[model samples]
Target: MKKNLSISARLTLVMILLLAVIYPLLIAAVGKLTPGKGKGETISVNGKVVGYERIGQKFTADIYFQGRPSAVDYNAAGSAGSNKGPSNPGYLQLVQNRIDSFLAHNPGVTKEQIPSDLVTASGSGLDPHISPDAARIQIKRVASSRGISMQKVTELVQAHIVQPVFGPAYVHVLKLNVALDEIKH
Candidate 1:
């Protein structure tokens, strides 16, 4: 029993060193090789950092296209999903509320036309990208609110679409909004 206890203690110490210390350092080193160099990628406008690249934020104004509803209220430090399954009553009600709110904001937008992404919070509440279709649906409202033509807003959304090598195309909400601001109305 003494020998077993000694072995367990040694194993625990080794795992703690590997997981707590070495793993974090290795991840940080790898992050340094990425775009933000261990920090998140920032989207800047006029030399001012407006927001991070892959972090979702609230955009409630009618002139701007809204992203997915966040379960964690877009709190980066508390990123999480609703954790309630689709069949759960409270979850259903929440989604229904989102649907109602979206329809209210987006006039002429039918419930069937609303994309699932727009009404449901993503698994990671920080999902910055939405499907191109989701952005397209909001074009009418944004164009009208901004006093721009729908064609122009459509073009802007098209320009922001990021086609990955594996998955379907997506638009980064923060980048799109920044670009929208840059457009001369």
Candidate 2:
């Protein structure tokens, strides 16, 4: 009976050890296999790596389209929202500040034309894509800065807009940057 109990105990210990080793390996493998914007390799242009899908960085040049506001400033490990409800006073203030900044940068734009994504933080605070409308709104500014026709800038935006892979949605920010690089060349 004692021998049988010892055997059972040994088996349990081995199983536990196996699980401990296998669990991490399984997790690592699954992480590698998972498909998402953040995990994929970033595309570069003109020997310059401008952005990453997982990190939100400022694209402030009038010649380039901008993306959404970030809460954690696009820190991947610190990804999170402001947690301020829409009605929160802090949220309102933050939005107002963004509007102010936008107006200061885009003197020719009307308040009605500014894209919502330009002032709003995405839920994850790490969103790399901006809405198509946001890209469109910046076309005039980009065109004026680059001395290109607005029509040409618009064409670039349309060409760069990533169509929905599985549904009717699109992303415009990264493509806009790539288009900007192309125009420069």
Candidate 3:
């Protein structure tokens, strides 16, 4: 019994060192190679740090493009989705309210033309990217609100499209808005 206990203790220590210490060190080393070195990647304009590229921000102004709906109210510390099922009455009403508000702000946009990402909170509620269709849908509103031409804003959105190696193209909402703000038009 003593011998078995000794071996078990030794194995436990070894496993803990290997899994907890070594594995985490390796992950940290890899993270160091990323853009932010384990910290969040920030987007800057003219040396001014605007926001992090990885976290979504709330943009209620009609002149700026909006990101996905956040159940946590753009509170990065409390990242979460609404967790309400599609069949839930409360969730349906919430989506309906978003749709109505979006329609009111965008006179020409129809309910069907609205992208799912525009009204639904993502699983993490921190997604900073939106589908191209989502950005395009708001182009008219943003252009008109900012007194910029639709063509220029559309070009900006097109320029910001990021095509992942395996997924559909998306535009980073914060980056797009920042770029839009910088444009002379």
Over 1-185, each residue of candidate 2 has an lDDT whose tens digit, in order, gives: 99999999999999987898888777777878676422665556666766665556667677778888888876676778767788999789989999988888777888898778779888888887887777777777788888988888888778877776686444557656776667766
Report the Cα lDDT for candidate 1.
0.89
Off by over 4 Å in 3: none
- Tens digit of per-residue lDDT, candidate 1, span 1-185: 99999999999999999999999999999999998998988888889887887788888899888889888888788889878886999889988998998888888989998889888888988898899989999999999988989998899999999999998889999889888988873
TM-score of each: 0.85, 0.75, 0.90
Which tens-of-lDDT digit does each residue in 1-185 have in candidate 3? Answer: 99999999999999999999999999999999998998778888889887887888898989899988888888788888889987999899999999999999999998999999899989888888899999999999999998879999999999999998998999999989888888963
Task: State the C-alpha lDDT per candidate.
Answer: 0.89, 0.76, 0.91
Tell me the deviation in Å of residue 64 in model 3.
0.6
Point out where model 2 deviates above 4 Å. Answer: 1-20, 23-39, 46-49, 165-168
Cα RMSD (angstroms) for every candidate in the order listed: 2.4, 4.3, 1.8
Model 1 vs. true fold: TM = 0.85
In model 1, residue pairs whose N, Cα or C atoms come closer than 3 Å (at least 3 residues apart or on different chains), thus clashing, are none
Sort every candidate by lDDT, greatest first: 3, 1, 2
Q: Model 2, 22: alpha-carbon shift in Å? A: 2.9
